[model samples]
Structure formats: C-alpha cells, structure tokens
Target: MWAVASLLPARRMLASAPRGDGRPVMLLPGLVNSDRSLFLMRRYLRRLGYDAVGWGLGRNLGARAIGGEGERLLARVARLHEESGQTVTLVGVSLGGIMARFVAHRLPEAVREVITISSPYAGDPRATRVWRMFERLTGERIDAEGVVARRVEIARPLPVPATAIWSRSDGLVNGLICRDPEEDGCRAIEVRSGHLGVQIRPAVLRTVADILAVPGQGPLGTFRP
Candidate 1:
C-alpha cells in the first residue's frame, strides 16, 4: 500500500517541483542499496533543471565508500566536480548522507551544500532496525573503537550548508535521533513519513526542490523548515 501511494505523490512533485539553476548534484543511495534506487529522484531533478547524477559505485558498502587510501566514492565526487566545473551539491539518503558529510568535510572547496533524507548520522546504530545487518554486511563491528570514532566524525557539522529531513514515524532508524545536532550550519525538516517513503514522498520532494532553488543563502539562513 505504501509503495502504491508513493507513486502518485512522486509523480505530482515531478510535475510541480520547483526548478533550480542547473547546478550539478550527486545523489547517493543508502547502505546496501545501489545507484538504481535513486534513478527516479535523479530523473526528477534533471527535469527540474539540476544536473543530477549517480554515485556510480553500484551497491553501497558502508565505510569503503569513504575509507581506505584511494576511496572510490571520493573519486566519483571529484570527477563530478571536475566535469561540471562547479561546486557539487550532495543529496544523500540514510547511510549515504553520512558519506556525504564526510565528503564535504574532506573537500569543502568542492562541495556547495548537503541534503540528507532519513539519515541517522547523529543517532546510535543500535537504535536502528538494520544495525546488526549493517554490521554483518560491512564487516565492521559497531562496538569497535575505530567504528565509533568514525561515527562521531560523521556527526560533526560540515563547512558548508546542510539540511536534514526526517520523520517521526520512521520505522528503520529512531526518528528522534535522525536530526541535526547543531542549527548553526544546518536545518531540520520534520515530515510525517515512513523511512522508506521519506525519499520519494511528494511533499519531501517538493521541499528538496524548494531548498535547492534558494539563491546564495542555500538552506542555512534561508529555509524555515
């Protein structure tokens, strides 16, 4: 039922969502998900005048996306920034949002802003429904010192503007923890949505479009929600 309901709203936003200034955007998918999961969002953003592209890293593999010496994920962001010759905005879902923050922190000059949907970067992994599964798939124990340190790093504010969109009804990650810790460089939007639908719901899509449409202020000092 949720899946069927999402289509109408998503379609509605596709037609009515505000257009942006053709800025380059990189859409990052959640953990264990692939670029295929973001195809619809990318298509919609493209139609709305933004140059949206995928991370092209296939299925997300947690830390590897942003860790190790030659990180393939960072390479992808760099390539996009170079190709577009403009600062890239990152729109990340779930774990992808955590990666986006890391990217913005590492390459602040190349990143313009970040928008996260249903991400638990500031939350405890144990509070998530799929925390165990994530640990299993990524082969990184949540209790490890290194893992905890990295999570702490991801929770910090980025040099650029940031926006976090979450819902109280989220079933996967505890919704309360899926918020921005600091409002100085970030703003939080509360929506009545499930974890899965937050990224595709019409209202959320419209909000994202509007956020991206803001001029020089980006969502930081401009967006109210």
Candidate 2:
C-alpha cells in the first residue's frame, strides 16, 4: 500500500527535494530483500543530485550475505570512499540499517553518516514481528549469547552523525526500539508510516535529503515533521 501510494506524489516530491553535493550514498535493502527493493529510492536520490547506489552484495542475509564479520561490507565502503574521495553516507532499510550501523562502527573513517529506516537496533530482537523469519533466514537464534551481545554493541552511540526514521504505526517492529533516545549524536525523526512504506514515502525521502544536506559539523536534532 505504501509503495502504491508513493507513486502519484513521487515525482512531485523528488522535484522539490533538497539537492545533494554529489556525495556517494549507498542504499542497503532489508532482510529477505535485495537492492531491487530500493530502485525507486535510488532513482529519487539520484534525481535529487546525489550519487546513490545499492549495497551491491545481492540480498541481505545478515553476516552470511555480507561475509564473516562484515569484511566484505567493509571492503565495499572502503572502495567507495577511495573512489569518491569522500566519506560515504549509508542509508539502510530495516535489517540493512542494522548492518549499516555495524559497518559504520567498523569503518568510521570511511563513513560520513548513517540513516536507518525503521531499523530496530535499540531493543530486543523479539520485539519485531519478523524475528522468527529472521532466524529462519539467517540461521541464528536471536536469544543466543553472541546475538544478544552484538545487539548491545550496535545499540550504543555511533561515532559519527546518525539519523533514525521510524514510525509508531509500524506493524513489523516495535517503533520504540528503532532509535536510541540516549544518543545525543543520533537524530530521531518520527513519521506516520508502516514499516515497509517508510522507505518509499515521499515525506521520508525529503527528510532524508534535508538531513543529508546539512553540513557535517552542523547539529542534528529531533525532527517531528
């Protein structure tokens, strides 16, 4: 429904959105999804004058999809940083956002900032409606010791600028856990959107562009629009 609703207004939204400074923005897809899911978003970003691309690693099946300990993901970011001669901005949806945070933690120097769309990185994995599916696809128990520890680690304050776009209307995950309230560096933006819809919603796209346009040294505060 969100994808369909986004169609009519997408063109108008893209036309009025804030332009980018040609910084490379990498879009990461959600669990059980591939770069294909974010085609519209990439197109919109490109239209907004940003060089946006997908996380070329096919599907996002957790560590398995990106290689052990995200070595492959790190390499991808490093390559983009080297090629662009600028820190890359990561925009991730759902599980992809979690992975983006992990990558940012691993390669802070190469990452400009991270933007997560409805990514539940702040709380229990079971709080999400798709935990069971996540386990089946990744073959990792959410309750396992390693998984729990990793969650704690990722939930901590990120070293660089961070933004979380989440919705209370999200049906797939607990919205409260999507952003870290204690992280002063992380800007939490609230929107009225379903879990999947938030990715393509026009308002969300505009918010992303606005955040991206802010200078690196500028302050990031909560956005309620």
Candidate 3:
C-alpha cells in the first residue's frame, strides 16, 4: 500500500527536497530482509546526492548476523568512515534500527547520527508480533538475561544525535515503545504509517532527507525544501 502511494509522491518530494553533502549514509534492512528491501530508499538517497549504501552484511538476523558483539557491523562503519573521511549516518528499519542503535552506542565517533523507522528498541521485545520469529531465527530467547541487558544498553541515551520515526498505527509492534520518552538526545517524529509502510512512505522519506540536510540542529529545526 505505501509502496504504491510513495511512487509518484516520493519522486516529487525528492525533486524539491534539499540535496545532501555527499556524506556516506548506510541503510540497514530489517530482520529476514536484505539490502533488496531498501533498494528504492537507497536510490532516493543517492538521487538526493548522498553516498548512500546498504549495511553490506546481507539480511539482519540480530547479533549473530552481524558477528557476535556486533564486531562485523562496527568494522563496516569504521571502513565507511575511513573511506568517506566523514562520519556515517545510519538509517535502519525495524530490527535494522535496533542494530543501528547498537552500532552507534559501540562507536559514536564514526557515526554522525541515527534514524530509526518503526524500531522497537525502547520497549519490551515480547510486545512485538515478531518476537517469536526473532527468537527462532537468532537462537536467543527474548527473556534471556543477556538479551535484556543488551536491550537496556541500546535503550540508553546515545552519545550522538538520534531520531526515531515511528507510527502509532504500526500493527507489528506497540508503537509507544519505539521511542524513549526520557531520552532528550533522541528526537521523535510521529508519522501516519503501518509497520512496513513507514519505510516507503513519502512523508517519512522527506523527513529523513530533511534531517540529513541539516546537522547539529534541534528536533524542530526547519526542514529544507
């Protein structure tokens, strides 16, 4: 539904939106999804003049997918930082967003900021519709001691700038848990979208581009168009 709605409108939105500074932007896909899931978004960001790329680690299967302790993902960020000579911006969707937060927390210096779409890092994992699937795929129980500790770590305030784009109507996860209300460093943007729709929604794409265009601004800073 959102993919169809975003087709023409997304093009128009990008046409008039502000361009980027050629900084490297990495798009992370959700669980059970690969870079193919974010192809359109990556193309859109590229058209907006940013050096956008995928996580390059294939599908997101939690820590096991990125190497235990997220070493592989961290190495990817470091490599992008070295090659681009600038910090990288991470845009993650669903489970991808959780991984993005983990990476940002582990290596703040290499990251410019993080933008999450319908990611439920701040809430209980069991609140999501996919928790069982997550456990099956990752071989880690949601209620495990390590998993709970990791969640707390990721939910902590990030050292770098952060933004969370979520939808209350998201059917897969409880939307309220997507953003931490007490985290002043993390900006929250509410949009009308379902769990999957948030990724392709025209308004969400525009918001992301706008955020990327301006740096070191408050959450309510004017969007460039």
Candidate 4:
C-alpha cells in the first residue's frame, strides 16, 4: 500500500500565505510540458502574494541541447537573481526538476532552493516508452554515460536542499527514487495524485505554498502525517 496518510482528499499545507512584495520564483515544468503547464501554480502563488514565473523556454520533453539549453536557463536565472536581488527558488516538475538540479549546480549563486515534483534525478533507465522516440529523433540522449552519471551524482547528497514530492500512483517515474539517500538537507513527501495532475492538485498547491513560505526549509516543509 502507498504510504499516503489519506487518499480521499489530498492534504494542503500552508505555513502561511506569502505576503506580496513580488518575490521572484521560477517554475520549471515537467517533460513534454510548456510554461503554461505551471499556469495553475503560478496563479495560486500570485494569490498567495508571490511573483512566481515560468521557465519561458519552449517544449521541455527533455534536455535537447544540454549545453545550449543549460546556458539559456542559467542566464535567465541570473537575470532573475539580479532583477530581484533575491535568491530565486527553483521549483521543477519531472524533467524540469532534473534540469533545475543542473542549473543549481552550475549557478548556486543564483538559486535559493530546489523543489522537484515526481522528478527522477537518478536517471530512470526504465523510460522505454514511445515518447523516448522523440529523444532519438531530437538526438537527446539521457542514457549517455556522462549524462546518466551526472544525474546520479546530483541526485544523491543533492548539491542543495532538495525536496521531492512523489506518489506511488505516479504512472511515470518510480516514487522510490524520490526519496533522498541522505536525509540531512533533503526530504521526501508522499502525495495522492496522478502523475500529470500533480501540478494542478490543490494539495500540491498548499504544499508548495507552505514550502515556499519558509526561506530555506528545503522539501516537505508542508509536512503532514
């Protein structure tokens, strides 16, 4: 059985709604997703009084050009950091989360914290689905020795305070991988929601608000039993 404390209603945890001074936060969407994917979360964060923005880059099925895309993301993060004079928190879902980790590693000066939703930082070699054909078509290889190894390295003892939210019901990445190998600055929380719906789920929204409210609490700040 899943370790879900409750399945009927996904729990919503909010440390306290943020006060709107338009603090900057970047929301990176999952694989096969676009900036619009974070629409709901953006709206919720705005309501809670935060200036949450999307990662503007187009379709994010996977890291097409690690070099180019990574640079683009890093530059954008740097801009946000300069504009806000605040350490912009990185919130990514799925592949976006993986990308966020890379950006954070390269530009720690620009990142505050990293929160991932159902993201498999430790390379899910089981991605044997039809979607991967796009990876081949686009020449993006997640299985490359260097790529997989880097992901594994960053996945454990994560370069930053990492918070992972996952569900056994996830039809995508294995939730087990969401658990941090070391517990010091990492946390793994269980949520009840489908893989795709996680972005819009109310419980996830509340959890996000709670987590963001804390300056440096890392993941699972929206703790619940």
Candidate 5:
C-alpha cells in the first residue's frame, strides 16, 4: 500500500488540499504507536500548508497516558494550543483517535476539529481484536469504572467539528464502531483500506486533505473509493 501510494503522488493531484490558512493540527498516534508512526501523515498536512504537529508525548500508553485532565496528553495539548494561538485540529489514528475525542470533549475551546481514523469509540470494546492487548497495556479492563465512564464520555458529541474515518476492510476494529453518532455536526467517511493502510493510502490522504480544507461542519466533500 505504501509503495503504491508513493507512486501516485496523490498530493500533487489534490488541488483542493491547500488550506492556505495554516491551521494548527495535532496528530495522536494509535496504541503502542509514537510520533514516528505518523511522520508521513503529518508531513503531508504540512506540505498542504497546515501547521501539523505530533502529540510529542511518546508512545501512546492507552488510558493511563490520557485518562485524566492532569495527564501528559492533556498537558501537551494545552501547551500546543497556548503556543499556537489557534484552535487545533486534533487528528488521531486508531487508539490515538479515541484519545483525541477525549481531548476534544474536555477542551473544545482549544480544538477546532477532531478527526479519528479507524477508531472504535462508539461500540463494544470487545468487538475490537486488540481489546485484550489494550487491557494489558493500560491495565484498565473494559468494565472498569474509569474505562467505562471514558467510553461514554468519548461517545458523546464534541462541541467542535468531528469526522470519523472508517474502512470496511479494517481488520483491527469493527468499522461499524467508527460511525459518527446521529448528530448534525458529525459525519463519517468510508475508505477502501485496511486499518493501518488508512494512514498512508493515497486516497485516504486525499480525503483527509479535502476534509481539512473545508471550513465548517463536515462530510464537507466526498472522494471516490
């Protein structure tokens, strides 16, 4: 997928990708992933004229890393918003997207938009293949107070624009769990890629770029499969 995506030069073909506004973008990597994993996505956003920045909080340690207002993840987001002088567009991949939803819910004023890629935030955690691994990593069982409460919290609508990008081909998380709630400000876009490929696939990149270029509530534009 990466090789084929590289050959497409999709960025060049995406004439509408350029925002020209230089909005600040914060990318959160998936579970067990770090800023390094999002290098390609962030670089692409930067090239399209957005101030794309990584979470910079090291590998995402699941609930423990972003479970509370006083955690490292929140602190980093606060610092970025303060320094950027702009509302940030939070973009997260897989588990990182779930974290982004939590951040957006907590600090809506600091976030302009929230985008999640293949994140299973709205359904049974057991539906995901990684739930057991997630439990081991975060030490928080699916039924635990904090984890359950957080699931409910993230499922609520964000005050900012929200987009959920899901793929039927995803093998990690159930695609249905990635759907946007029945709310006016939120929308879901379906892509043709695997869970990980959603990050680097050219079509997915074009879709993301197009979404970011739009100004208001989204599903702003559509892309071909």
Candidate 6:
C-alpha cells in the first residue's frame, strides 16, 4: 500500500535529486500524515545540496497505545548515521516535533540539530474553550499537563541545537505554545502562518533552506531575518 503511495513523491523528488549529497536531512511530517505529505519539502531539500529522507513512518498520531515509536525514530537516525559520517538533522512539523525530540533524547549521538514547525511544545490543550471542541472533534488526546511536564523534562540542556519554528497565526494548536528558552541549545523563532501551512508557507520554506545552508551548523542555525 505504501509502496504505491510513495510513487508520487518519488517521481516528484526525482526531478530534483542531482544536487542531493552533502548533508543528510530528514523531514518528519505532522499528525496523521505520511511521508507523502512531506514530499515537496523533501524534494526541495534534496535539490538544496542535502540528502533528504522522509520519516516514512506512516503517520504521527500522538503517542498513545503504541509503544516504542521512539525507538523506531532512533533506529532511523542510526541508519542515516551509518550511511553518512555525520549526524542527521531533523525537521519536524507539529506532533512530529515531539517525536523528533524523543528521538534526539535517545540518540543524541545521531542527531546534529532539531527544528520544529508549529508544535505545541509548551502545551495548550485548554488554552481556549474552542480548543476543547477542536480536540473532541479531532480526537486529539492532549493531556496538556502531562505533555508540558514531559516536554520540560526533555528540554533541560537539550542534547542538540534546537529551534522551535512557530507562528502567531496558527489556529489549530495555540500559537502561544511557542516558547523561548535560555538554554544555549534551544531557540524559538516566530513566523507568520497558519498551522496547516507551516510546512508549505513560502517564508517557512525560505527559512528552512537558509537554515540548511549554514556550515558547521545543524538544521537550527543563528536566527536570520
């Protein structure tokens, strides 16, 4: 099933793979998304002097019931590490950001840097009455307190350079979920976008490209205007 589903992205990506070797980058899609959802971005990254890979993990339906997904993420990074001498940089969107963080935690040796797009790292499942309804309708199992506490723990002295790319216009997850951390490895950046567009927004695309361009810098580089 996924083999056929992967065709479109593969064809789309092939049109731009010649420039794809120096660095290794992995684009991890958001909730309920498959590797196909990140096709375009992967293609662009591959075109930008990087060997880009899709998470290929089917979907990012929050961490529940299913156990060991974190281990799977680490395995993926390890695979990439074996192929390339350096660690892989992660670019995750929404819930995938959480997965990326978890992966970095278990396999810091395999991760060079991490960047999250519009993820609710701070937690805001009940920031607004509307969100409760949103959760009910979407079946988002968000235990804000649990998520926040867990994230805070993962956040202390983050293992790699990390950046949270957020937008005030994000509607799904509360925009305020974007946070600033004084830890040298973590930084928060603000963009103008809606949650769903975080992956395709033009400004974001440019930012992602520029971030990938820095030398000796992981996916998260010094903030640029």
Per-residue alpha-carbon lDDT of candidate 3 for residues 196-219, written as tens digits (9 for 90 to 100): 756777877888888788754666
**Model 4 off-target regions past 4 Å?**
1-21, 65-69, 127-134, 218-225
Assess the local accuracy of residue 201 in candidate 5 as a C-alpha lDDT between 0 and 100: 78
- State the lDDT of candidate 1 residue by residue for 145-192, as single tens digits: 888887887788778988888877788998777776565778787777
For every model shown, the clashing-pair count is 0, 0, 0, 1, 0, 0
Q: What TM-score against the true fold does each predicted structure earn?
A: 0.90, 0.94, 0.94, 0.82, 0.91, 0.75
Better of 3 and 6 by TM-score: 3
**On residues 1-225, what C-alpha lDDT tens digit does candidate 2 reach at each position?**
756666685677567767878999999999989999998889988988899999899889987888856888899999999999999999999999998899888899999999999999999888989999999998889988888877888898898889988888899999999998788789888887888657778777778888888834445545665
Worst 10 residues of 2 by lDDT: 215-224
Q: Candidate 4: global Cα-lDDT?
A: 0.70
Lowest lDDT sum, 10 consecutive residues, model 4, at 1-10
Off by over 4 Å in 5: 1-11, 14-16, 67-70, 218-225
lDDT by residue for model 6 (1-225), tens:
433344455553334333444788988887667788888788777766788898766766555312324556677778988889888989888867767777788788999888888766665446433445535533544566665565666555568878788877788777666545555667677777777656865556656765655523543323433
Question: Against the true structure, what is every candidate's RMSD?
Answer: 2.6, 1.7, 2.3, 4.6, 2.2, 6.4
Off by over 4 Å in 6: 1-21, 64-66, 128-149, 215-225
Among all windows of ten consecutive residues in candidate 6, which has the lowest summed lDDT?
A: 215-224
For model 1, what is the C-alpha lDDT against the true structure? 0.80
Q: Scored by CA lDDT, what does every candidate get?
A: 0.80, 0.86, 0.85, 0.70, 0.81, 0.67
Residue range with the least summed lDDT across 10 consecutive positions in model 3: 216-225
Q: Which prediction has more favorable TM-score, 5 or 6?
A: 5
Q: lDDT per residue, candidate 4, 27-143, as tens digits? A: 998766788888878877887788799988777745563343477778888999998999888888877777887888888887888888877665464642333654664466767
lDDT (Cα) of model 5: 0.81
